[model samples]
Target: VQDPKHAKKTARNQLHSGARLLVLGNNVMLYRHLLTLAQAKNHAIYIRDVVNVDKQDDGAAYRLFHSDVLEQMYQNELENNEMQSLFVYLFVLGDLFDSYLNRNIFHKERIIMAMRGYFFLNMWAEYIES
Candidate 1:
């Protein structure tokens, strides 16, 4: 779970399951711990970043980053044994938000601006239809 956005839920689940939970200063430390735990448990771990897209039809390259909790979990899984473990990056590009342009009323133009920037970099617009 490299995503800090959803770390709270993951942390809670780990604690509830009687797994030791520790929050290191940085992602590197967290990744190390996850590796150690996976080895000890004899269970393969996998990791991948999950992208949450607000719109399916609106092509966006990268969507909302996963929550921190999720990110850490993913990192741990990846650092362990990505090959054997079932690592999946879930993307909800279409269902995460209403309109891609106006995630919030205040920043109506922000998404559009981002798209323009993306186009400039890639030399083409990528639109994902929901």
Candidate 2:
């Protein structure tokens, strides 16, 4: 179903039939798919762009920890023990810490971020070390 035309047709059909769409693809594909859906019904689509969040490292860790993404990553690590997905969680934490440190953030916030980084480091040490 990688065909652009087929993908657009499916997306349009799903939108017309009142079904929720979950599309997973690269940026170009996603952009085209979104365009197709928007064209299908003007001013009817509500798009929440969660795919582009790398620029916001400060709240990235907080949002990930509070959201289902962390749980999903944990489940993936439990099943696969690949350590790759787990690394992403830890990496985000590190990125958040770096972002906080580089900026003149509040001391209390920095302390909290440091604690979070430490906690995850200890929790995922074994997997990370492997």
Candidate 3:
């Protein structure tokens, strides 16, 4: 298993240097650890699936290796980061939000913002009650 601290250090150093990282492996633990660290640091990472031609040709079905926990964590981190970007685009770019709305792409953002707002309100309520 890759050390979590080492993975974090590598990811941070790479991002700081504006370099792309390509980790070629099927180690679920390593991927999860790196992704968790990336989420904590508000860093953006993209995952591209690489299909195995050998497996396909061998008549062996291609199956996803990641567990549900890993997939959920990845999706949550991605949506959270996208939500942050949505605000930045709306405030900083000025015209980008209008363009998204014109293309009907704002509906997804509307749902994400509503869900996030609800989550924060629940957290605040719990804090106040406690």
Q: Which TM-score value belongs to model 2?
A: 0.28
lDDT of each: 0.31, 0.39, 0.33
lDDT of 2: 0.39
Clashing pairs in 3: none
The full ranking of all candidates by TM-score, starting with the best, is 2, 3, 1
lDDT tens readout by residue for model 2, 38-129: 23333223333223323324343333333243444344333543434333543545444443444676777777766776676576565445
Q: Pick the candidate with the highest TM-score.
A: 2
Off by over 4 Å in 2: 1-91, 127-130
The residue-by-residue lDDT of candidate 1 on 68-104, one tens digit each, is 3235445554555432121221212111222243346
How many Å off is the CA of 118 in candidate 3?
Answer: 0.5
Number of the top-ranking candidate, with lDDT as the measure: 2
